[model samples]
Structures are given as structure tokens and as C-alpha cells.
Target: MEHMDSSMDIQHLLMMGMDLYRWTFHDNWSEVVEQYKNNAAIHTMPINNKEDTALHVAANNNNAVAVKQLVDEIKRTTSAVESLKKKNGKGDTALHCAASIGSLQMCMCIIEADPHQGHVLIEERNKDGETPLFLAAAKGHKKVFFYLKDCCVGESIGLCRRTSDGQTVLHCTLYRDHFELAFEIIHKYKEGIVGFVDEKGISPLHILADKPSAFESSSNFRWYNWLAYQCIYVKPLRITSHSKSQQTALRGSTADTENPASNYISEHENVVPKNYWTSYDIFMAFTRFIIWPVWEAFGLEVIKTSRKKKEKHVWCGQILDGLWKHKDVAYVGGRVKAYVMPKPGRETDGPKGDAKQSADGGSQKVTADQDKLQGDAKQSAGVGNQKVTAD
Candidate 1:
């Protein structure tokens, strides 16, 4: 049996594949129906050129009817499902071929006909180690990509197989300028896809940073739009009527007893507006959060004035880079070593697992910060008590 299967030649498969492909031009698949009746070989033979079956050819040609017929024929035999999975020379099944062509109907026909069970082929990878979802994304086929994503019922969209270089479909979508598709991937797999970094320690955030144009193409920063008060997008709103509200949320706003807007704004629409960043942002994001506190944390006051720093209109990325660069400077006698980001989502891990060991060393700094927080909390609690004590 093995010898017989191996003996099937290129000429035989081509003849079979060609016959099936010819039927796709018909309005009702009449030629295919006739061919299926008169010649079963055309339906059963594997095209040896790319190792594709007739279904592969039909899918590439975008003939949903032909794809379904081929799928149905395969379903007639239990072992034929194995044939459906057979890859061409490029390691693509019929579903992969359909995805490459952005044919949603053809893909539906192929997966729906799966004799093996629910959506096994949806996760199948091609020669590049990409699932059908990745192919659709790379080809800029948003509709087809979502269809496959929806088929992922009870499981992930099978983004498990990255390219040989270790990039996921998210990487491919962003690289291809498939912003709509990329957003869909992020929406469907936020935690799993967004934090995914390739071998180079690059996350989707890194990709988005490189391609800010992607924002115009399909902006999803709305989730953070409300968070703009963090000092990136809220600058514009501040020059207007929202400052008191901003001040109230971050600091305490009780001083403005006459200004109800401040209290109302803080009570409702939380977090505020700004340009990407400003002097206030620089302090809030970096200096106030780290620098001023660092001296107290490590009992090293000289560290602040030890060096004259260049004053510049630092943007968000620059501020982040600076902080990550100097994050460990608080360590006792720590010379500035070259900076390395923890694996995406592992920023707290420090330089590899070695940072994991010193997890105990920061207890003092944490306690100090915590104690300060406790003091502030008590103050806030006391204020609350005073306000209610009158009642």
C-alpha cells in the first residue's frame, strides 16, 4: 500500500487537478458533476507538482462550489480527511490556499467539510509555519481572517505557529500595514497577542511605536483615550476647563470649595487630557515617580545633583527609555550597566532571572514607599472622616 501511494506520479496528479480546475468555470459545476460520475480518478488523485489535491486547486481558484464538492468527496471516506491535511510543496492545505487568496466562502466550505472533526484544519500551518489566520493577515484579508478567528470556537485562533523567524500573525499584520486586521487580532487575543514578542524582544507595542501611521489607519487608543489624563493626550483638554478636574484626581481638590466643576469632573469622567507630554508629564511620569523618591529609598541624596542632565522636551518613548535605562541606578554602588528590557510583560523581572534573585533586596524600598502610601492613605481617610463627622 505504501509503495502504491508513493508510486503516484506528477503526471497523474496534474491530469487529475487540471480536470477538476476546468470545471470551476461552469455556472453550476455541471462538468464536475459529470466528471465525478464518469471518472472518479479526477476527484481522488493528488497533484504531485505542489502535493496539492483537487480541492487545493479549486480553493486557489476561488470556486466555493468546487471546494465543497472536493471536501464532500473526501468526507465519504474516513482516511480522506488525512488527505485534506496533506500539504503542497509549500506545506499549505486547501484552507491555507483559500486564505492566501482571501476566499472566505472557499475556506468555509473546506473547514465545514472536515471529516476529522471541528476546525482541525483551521490551526494547520503552511510552509512558513503560519496558520491560515496568519496567511489571511499577511494578505490583508480582514474578512477572511475574522472568519477563521470565529471558527476558533472553544480555543484560541491557533496563532501558536509563528513564522520561522518567530513572528506571530500580529507581527505580520503590523508589518504588512494591515491595521484593521492587526486590530482584530489584538481585539481577539489581547493578552496573548499584544504581549507576544518575537525572538528580538519586540512586542506589538514596539511594532506600533515603529508604525505610528498604524494609528491613523485604525486607531484603538480609545481604551487609553480616557487614560490620556496620564499626560499624553490630555494636554489640550487641560488648557481649557478640565485642569481643576485633573488636579482633583491626581492630588487633592478639596481646596477649591467654591469650584464645583473640579469635584464633579473628578467624581465622573476620571483620568484627563494633554499633548503627548509636557514638563508636568516629565515630572509625573519620571521624576516624581522615580527620581525624587529614589534618593529617599536608597538614602542617596547626592544621586540627584551628581550629574547635570540635558533639559529637553522629552516625549513618552524617550521618558520610558530614560527610566528603564536608569531604573537600577538606585542599587548600592551600581555602575550604569547597559540596559535591557525584560521580556514583554516581564518588565519587573529585570535583567534576565538574575533580577529575580534580588527580589528580596527591594523590600526596604517597597516598605518605605508603602509606609509613605500608608501615611497618605491615613490623611485621605482622616479627611473623609472629617467631612462625614459633621453629619
Candidate 2:
């Protein structure tokens, strides 16, 4: 088991692959640890065409135990931080792999393995300029996204929260229909990202508008499902003023700027929930238990779907209100208006239908099309009967 550097040696190693890489790809943690005991270089050796090390394979495969073991083994023989920073062909580090796959355990294992400089992983962008935070949000991994987001502070905040294409995490979350998370991002980083426009000149508001199904007007539900939707109470989401003040204080603190861990605030810290169930909760639970079987038996998932749609609608409104209140409202509003309004030449001439089957049935006159026809007749028929033209 000699360390090889030449291309021929690398090819030979690829042909007769090392035991450590083999065990890692197949997820044999015990053998992987045993191999590390023999040679620590095995952990950092390129394992495949992608140049993925054993640690990269382990992290991508999401073996939390293996990742922890390998991180420890790498720490003893080499700089664990340097090994963690090693990028594959796509320039994705082990942390990026962990974040993309939505493995919170693996992410924590990798990042916390090097706490002093773990924030470096969060800030490191791939070839596409996507930080691990952007990948987490794009993949709809809320916990991993939050963990990576909490690691971002000051300048790293903007770097981690946005991509090279100028798309922010808010845009990704909205495009993925993660309305609740999008709403949280709106309030949390309103000053920086609420009004962000991507390279395509699309804002978060434009993305929200594209999701018509999120609005009540787009939902065509049955009467019963709509009733159930109204009955099913969803607790609205809001960030408390205390949390806002805390965020402000954290941003202003110079000490927190250097240490990403210090900027984290638990999601539950500001909430003081009631210990006992309310009467409404008891009643709702009873009603749900009684009718839940019928609801499921008939495959009437609309109740659940409706609840989700309503929640999305609520969050959408809240997000809009928050953005409207931001200092960049004029900019955001103008961008949204531009996106929503039909371009000068692209506007539809009128409603799609024939003149004979008009909604007013020949009684109404002076419609745009008819006015155009009348104007045409004025040129041809000399304008005398413009007011009395027959159908």
C-alpha cells in the first residue's frame, strides 16, 4: 500500500481499487476504519473519476458513523480542515455533498468535526458559485438549509445565501414551492435579499406569482373540501420582534462576525407555547379522529391539500406584506409590476371569442374589436352609420 502520484499509478489504483475506497463506496464502516488504521492517506486518495475521496464518498452516501470516523482518522494524520475542503470534479466539497443530499447528521458530522474553521465550508462555492446553503435550499432540505444558513454571518451571509446567477435562496425556495421556508427567509434577510433579482431579471415576487396554485383563487376545490379547509386551523408563522432585535444585535456584534457558531439562534427559543390543549384543539382532534377514516378511505387528500394551499396562501400574503414594507419596495414593486404586466406588443388584443357569441348577445357595443371594426368601416363606409352598424 504505497502512496502513488503518477497518472499510471493512479490508473493502476483505479483498476485494482484500494480497500478503503471499496469499503467506503459499499458503506462498510468497520473495514473503512480498519483501513484508516493502516494508512491515513487512503482517506484523502482520489477514489473515482470525479476525484471523490473516501470522505467524499462517505459523506455523499450519508453514513453518519463512517463520516465521523473518517473525520477523526483524518484529524490524526493530516489537517482535517484541509481534507474536508477537498473538492470533487464539480468543485463540491464533502459538506456540499452532505448539504445537497439533505443529510443533517452527515453535515453536522463534517462541519462540527472542524469547529474553528467550519464556516469556511459554508462560504466555499462550487464551480457554479453555489454555496452549500444554496444547494440545501434548492434541494428543499429545511433543516440542512437552516443549519447552513445559521453558519452564515456578515459578508458570508450574502455569499452563502446567493448564487453566481444572482438568484438568492429566497428565489430557490419560492420556485420549489417551499412557501413556509421562503416566508422565513423573507423576514430573516429582508434587508439583503427580499428585493434581489436574478440574472434573468426575475425577483422573488415574480417566482411567487408563477405559483398560481398557491393562491386560493387558483384552487378549485369541492364544497366539502373547502369546508374542511376552513375548519382545519393552521397556526400562522411569524418572527417575533424579540427575534428581530436579537438578529440586529447579533449582526452588530463584532465578536459574532468571526465565529459563525455564535450567530445561531434556535427556532424554538422565542416561542412560549401553552402546556395544555385548548378546547378548540380538543374538539378538532375529536372531529378529525371521527372523520379521518372516511377522509382517507375516499382518497380525499384534498383536505390535506387544501390545508397546504391555504397555508401557502397565508405565507404568500405575509411574504408580500413583508417585502412591501421593506425599504426596497419601490424597486421590488417595480420589478414585480414589470414581470406581471403584459409587455407592450405581447398583450392580448381582447378576450378569446367570436363577436356573434358575445357575452351580452349583440346588445353591447363598442367592444375593442367592434370599435376597431367600426373605425375600419368609417374609412370604407364614410362614417355616416358608424353609430348604427348592423351585426
User: Residue by residue across 242-358, what tens digits does model 2's lDDT show?
Assistant: 222233344223342223443344354434555323564577788678877688789978787767766776666666566556633213332122112111123221112121111
The candidate that wins on TM-score is 2
Off by over 4 Å in 2: 1-16, 240-273, 276-294, 330-391
lDDT of 1 by residue, 147-227 (tens): 666666454433533656557676676676554455445544444444444545444444544543222222222333323
Using lDDT as the measure, which candidate wins?
2
Candidate lDDT scores, in order, read 0.49, 0.61
The CA lDDT at 58 in model 1 is: 77
- Model 2 steric clash pairs: none
Lowest lDDT sum, 10 consecutive residues, model 1, at 306-315
For model 2, the local distance difference test gives 0.61
